[model samples]
Target: MKTSYVSNLAIQTAMRMTIQQNQMDLLKATQEQTTGRHYDVGLTLGATASRSLNLQREIDRLNSMKSTNSVVTQRLSGSQGALETMAKAAEKVRDTLVTYKGNDAASQLKIQKTEILGALQTFTAAANTSFNGEFLFSGINTDAKPLADYTATSAAKTAFDAAFTAFKTANSITSDDQITVTQMQDFIKNTVEPMFTGTGWDANWSDASSQNMTSRISASEVIESSTNANTNGFRMFAMASVITAELMDKNVTPEVRAAIGVEALQYVEQGIAGLNAERSQLGISESRVKKANTSIDAQLKLVNTHVADLEGIDPIETSTRINTLKVQLETSYTLTSRLQQMSLLNFL
Candidate 1:
């Protein structure tokens, strides 16, 4: 039989290693208890760690979508407000035209012209409204102003002058009042009307895209998120306002004035209808976004519950293990102390 004697140094070293291991276990158990989660998820989950990883990725994705949805909702709300402002301005001008139709009284017609011009200015401002540093009515061209200002120096004003000058030259008329009701209607139909369509609008009035903006509100759903100034409603509003403001002060008879008022009112009504339709379409998209968020929230709750179950630690069991580790550390320390005292020199 071979006998080997173990030195106190070796015994103390082994006890110290055990104490160190117990302290580490105690720290891990305490963390698990406080966090209510696994401290070493990969180790504990082992083969199923991939499942936890995938679920966490899903949570991140859903959270990102939710954040994006919040921005989309703000944009939609801003668009709705701009449309509402435009609609109200149109309605105010329409009412003024209706009330003062055929009056031809300089004061009343002047007031009516002022009202129409104001509405046009309001509409233009609304059309060019911006939200979050982007134009609300610019469609995909959000970085640029949607509608050109109808100022004296603006392209829209220059185009209108050219169109009207051509109309006067074509009819061989020297003055606005010399123009008959039939001639005025012809000018509007053939000249002013055409300017609001095709390349004319794009070149002179609108910088917006005919194609509106679309957004993904959910994983599988996408919808039109914004409307553009190039829509018929916006075009009609500009047309009616320009005609009323520029032609109302003409030295024409009440009959001609009435004819112009009638034409403008018709255009204003059409513009109102167009704006209402845009609002309706945007409202639908807003509703869909809200519903998508609700669904996402539901999915988040379910995914979080599964994640909790997968990575959760039992507080009671972790606390018990912590206590056991503490007791073992204390015992190791006591044994180490005894070993330190058990030197052969103490016996001598």
Candidate 2:
């Protein structure tokens, strides 16, 4: 009787073990069929978990760069457009100055003044361009407007008035004889140049900032994200614009204004030249950003491939495994059922 009871207990224990194993197999097979991946990633890639984790980290970084690059690219494009606008306006100023200086009719002079003022406004507007309400040319001070308006009461006009007055006082004469080309040269060198060079110029006015903004486009690379209004080329453009307005003011004699007009041509040429230089620089930066974006995308793709290899299962193989597990489960259930039917009456 003791032996028979011991045999029954052993059969029950074995059946219990078989049922538990079958349940685990069914659970694994169900997961594989539903998800098409091995249910146990830790078991499959335990040896490479460290490497897989590292690659995942890199992938995360690349994704972050992609998000940031979207906005960076837009800012760069906006900057480039703003620069082109300003450069074209400078060209217009240069062309109009040629026309204005050539003809001295009161009607044409008045018309040219209107045109110059319009160009000045264009320059101001270009300098103050914003993307999403943030100033593009304000450098790090993106919240600040880059240039004040060109009205007579604005800071830029006030600086010009003060500098022009000082220039006239220093020369000690107001006649055409004292305001020849030689005098124009002297005035620019001693007056306007100083205003741009020394602390007096930037201190008194100059709304445009000298600050530059930079961005990290890649892990090891940083690039300038924007250009400022206070660059040398931009400064020269401002000088030419201011000179055009001054010449149009008719504050001096016709002959004096004409001579100064000739002198102003030099500034117009320099400003145009400066515009070209700045545009070239911006073009190079744009190219760098494009290349960096490409590199980032490529890295993400390669890293994701590595991650799949490390932890992912083949769909075909997982399907085969699910079938095998189902067959084993059916066999285990059949055997457990037979064992559960055993009894002492059958043994007698």
Candidate 3:
């Protein structure tokens, strides 16, 4: 009797263990069928597991880059458009100066001044553009505005107005005649350049951070995200705006206004050239970003193919496996249920 009882216990234990294994197999097969990937792909693929993992990781990285590149692309497109508009505005100013070589008529001067003011405002607004709360042109200083409102009583205006007045005063001291290119050169070197220097001017010549935004476009490549606002082109625009801003200043003598008008005709050409050069640079960077994105997407498609080959399972085969396991598990349960109760009479 004792021996029979011990044998019965052993049989029950083995049967239950088999049932547990069948349950695990059923769950695993079901999971594989649902996901269409091998449950133990690493073990199934063996030596190729490393390659699959690498491919998967590469795909993940590419996806991340694709996301960031989209944002950068938007910023570059907007930047290009804004810069192009500024260039046209500066060109219009040059054209106007060419045509209106005479006096500062209220209506015509108003039109020219309006155009320059529009360009200046556009430049500043573009400089302060933010995407995802990041200032696109502020370099590494993503949180700061790169330019101040030119009309405000702000430090930028104050510094510029003071410098222009000083230039006029210094020239007045030197000669009572018309403004000369030589005097303009001196004013630019001594007065303008110094004000733009670090310590002399309180207002930021440019509040843009010095560090350029960058991104890894590929496994082996990095690219700049956008252009900074501190270029010589920006300086030229500011200078043109300053000269144009004094169009209606009642304090200046007609000779001084005519002298400024004369200087403007020559200076605006340089501003247009500066804008074009910078635009070319931005165009180059934009081309590279687009090219890199194309390469990234192509590589991602190929890598994804490699990953699917290594880790993917056939849906039909997975479904069959799942069904077979379920049947086997049910059979085991039925067999367990049918086991006769142990009794002394049966043993006898």
Candidate 4:
């Protein structure tokens, strides 16, 4: 009787130990399936979190770059349009000046002057053109006006209001001369140039020179003389000074007038070349922006892929693993239930 009791006690103890071991194994398997993380305490949580955060930061950086590129592209497109208008206006001025010189009649000359002045006013307005409320040609000083207002009777007004009105057939000239090439240039020099010294637009000026006419003209006397020579305020006085004195004199022969026309054409050609160069430079910048955007997009895609690898789980694989864990857990519970029914009498 004593031997049988001892045997039963030893068997019961062995059975309990086996059940406890199975329960612990089942718990570990369930945890693995539910969490998809291996049971390990040595894994570096800080390092994993830092890597994830870094990828997110990179994604944010690329997004910001894309936004900046879009703005620059828009600005560059508007600038291209403004440049085209400027080139067209400069060409028209040259043609009109040539035609005016060809005709010996003072009446015709006055008429041509009126037409040229009107064209100049139109060009000046265009030069002070804006994109999204910011002046396109005002360098980096978008807030400052590129052209100053010149009231018709103001001391600085050089062009005749009567002539401009006759040409336009409308009072679009208003009661003011509006603005002139010289004043506009001066405004750019003083306000716009400094802000753009090391920027893309700075290359438009000669050498490292400031856009200021005073610095560019060098000789104070010559600058003053050119300014005084401009009887019409809308005239580009510095450029106009290139025309020989012999060609400008009212008493000069028809031959001299022809010569002056040729010189004026040359000057116009030079101005066109300069504007074309600027347009080309803008084109290059636009191209660089496009390339940069493409590169940024590629980087963002790579980051996204890496992030998915880190955090995103495959649904099919996860489902399969969970089902396997459920089966194992159910089998362990069934075994534990059968063990509870076992006793010395059942064994006998």
Query: How do the predictions measure up, each by TM-score?
Result: 0.90, 0.79, 0.75, 0.53
Error of 2 at 5 (Å): 17
Worst 10 residues of 2 by lDDT: 1-10
Candidate 4 lDDT tens digits, 61-164: 77876775677777777767876776676777677776666686867765665655565556556656777786665544555455433335532233222323
For candidate 4, the 10 contiguous residues with the lowest summed lDDT are 222-231
> Candidate 4's error at 285, in angstroms?
1.0
> TM-score of predicted model 1?
0.90
Give model 2's TM-score versus the native structure. 0.79
Q: Is candidate 2 or candidate 3 better by TM-score?
A: 2
Best-to-worst ranking by TM-score: 1, 2, 3, 4
RMSD of 4: 14.0
**Which ranges in model 2 have alpha carbons more than 4 Å from their true place?**
1-40, 170-181, 204-209, 320-348
How well is each residue in 1-348 modelled by candidate 1, as lDDT tens digits? 998976878778888899889988888998899889999999999999999999999999999999999999999999999999999999998988888877877898789888888888899888888988999888899898999888889888898888888888988999777989999888888888888866789999888887888888889999999999989899888888999998888888777888888899899899999999999999999999999999999999999999999999888888889889988988988998898999778989
lDDT of 3 by residue, 15-58 (tens): 78988998888888888877778899888999989988888888
Error of 3 at 254 (Å): 6.6
* Residue-level lDDT tens digits of model 2 in 1-348: 354334666767776787688678778867866765557766777877788779879988898987887888898899888888888888888798887676767788788778877887888788889997889887888888776677878766787788767776777867434565666667776777666556554654455567788889899988888887777766777777777777555645677677667666777678778777877877888889899999998888888888777767777776777678778768878877787777767788
State residue 54's C-alpha deviation in candidate 4, in Å: 0.6
- Please identify model 4 stretches exceeding 4 Å from their true place: 1-46, 149-256, 317-348
Model 1 bad stretches (over 4 Å): 1-12, 326-348
